[model samples]
Target: MTLNPLSTPLCVVQATISQHGERAQLVGLSMPSAPFGTLPWQLIGLANYIVGCQTSDTAPSPETFTAHMQARATSAIPSPATLYPYTPWHDGRVRLLLDVTLGPAKVLKWPQASLVIMEQESGSGSCDWVRLSRERTAERILTRTVWEIEAEAQLLAGRLREAPDPSTSSLLEVAQKAARWARESRKAARAALTISQAARARHALRMR
Candidate 1:
């Protein structure tokens, strides 16, 4: 189904989850994009970043894309062989919304399609684009997880070293020790990623 919001330049695509191959599933997605004049890359990028899900092929039609979104919702659960969705939360309000931009392209017919659209290609650079935002979520998650673990480890180690008697160490002591180890491990991981990203940037520059 299509939900035409009063929001200018953005068409909200709302679809009931369509399923195939013995898996009856339900999914909902909200993609924010220009209803027309949007680029495929923009759509792809926005969807990937905002939704954190994988899509096959470009979005050919509104209906088909909706199906894809539905499948994403289903795969989110522990059902079968689907990739993990990049959904940050299960809340409906936070769900990814699709905004279809009506570019210069036109579709002559309707209702004959089971999918919102058929296969089509952009005329080079004609995409609805948006600067990636809040994109560091993955890196942030990694960093935070590592940092917390590392901090815990350090705390434990500090406690242990100051322990009046190492022989009397008990569960709490053991936990603090583990936390200390985790903190260190996290620190190393954070550093590795930072170094890797920097190197990657350098490599990309050289390639460019």
Candidate 2:
């Protein structure tokens, strides 16, 4: 979909939970530009690019993959393989959080992308990954999971509210909106988690 500046950008996340359910990891995609103008199909393209790069020893060039994904985006039918497992959560942008169970292959094959793992209980600490925030330097290409992102949004909104300058009004407005979105997103994330857990339970029972 074509998006304007006023339109909320869609942020897609590929999240993986461990077998023991003690920790969670996320797949972060590198964007060509700021997410403002991104299309829905392009998000799918990003996920496809990651799979293409990681699944094979020799990875396709980003350009080649972009072309391929763009072509695939034209299909009228959406593929379940490409569909995200979790319902999307909206913060400053619309977040499409996808889920998967982390398997034996823990290594990230893509050089440009990275996997960030976090404790399910603590929701703290990460190795080789950075939280998604505006203050992050341009060189870094990774983003944290939904919870962290939502927390950041709330913190930013609070800080904006504390600013004494009248000039911050517009910024504060945006921040407040983001905070509200974060809360709504959290609700969606919780619902998604419950559903995911139930589905996993069913699968385990069937395997017995």
Candidate 3:
């Protein structure tokens, strides 16, 4: 059965300065199966992520979606995590569930292509539990700042490829180069953040 599009899970990963030096929020979308459930989450998220490109007040801030699969990749123990989007239908807050046994897999297969919304057999009482089965939801939140950089790079490259004038072509090529450089810089920043987090973890362990 098809699930409700508006009911899809949305997890807020971070609230920080965006690539444009403006306040923004990064979110993750967990997808369980391919051919997403007709929800425009990624499209919406992409638009939010590129809001800096637009010069409109109504445009949303830089938000991103990190797609994840609910299935366990390795044959080892299964540990999983889940998030519930903020919906008005429920109480003021929603419950996020995490499974210690089964872990989630990052579904990098063509961006939300393998996401499936899980459903429970019983329709009464534990509706949230039902939604957990095979639900296409984001398990872990990654710094989505790279998405904007990568998108800008792609846009610049496309413009360069289709430039009608030599001057415009040169400018687009230069922009594309800069965008690529920025994308690389974002990658390096992410790597550095990972290292920083590891170091903090080690320090915390030693302190204990």
Better of 1 and 2 by TM-score: 2
lDDT of 3 at 40: 25
* TM-score of structure candidate 2: 0.30
lDDT scores of the candidates, listed in order: 0.33, 0.36, 0.32
lDDT of 2 by residue, 85-192 (tens): 333332233333222222322233332333322111111345323233221110121122223434544654666668755544554454345445444533443454
TM-score of each: 0.24, 0.30, 0.28
Clashing residue pairs in all predictions, respectively, total 40, 0, 26
Q: What is the Cα-based TM-score of model 1?
A: 0.24
RMSD of 1: 18.7
| Candidate achieving higher TM-score, 1 or 3 | 3
Task: State in Å the error of residue 77, model 3.
Answer: 52
Off by over 4 Å in 1: 1-169
Q: Which 10 residues in a row give candidate 2 its minimum summed lDDT?
A: 134-143
The global Cα lDDT (0 to 1) of model 3 is 0.32
Mind giving the per-residue lDDT tens digits that candidate 1 earns over 33-152? 322213322233223321222112122343444445455433211111122233313222222233222111112111111112112222336662332122123234323334434454
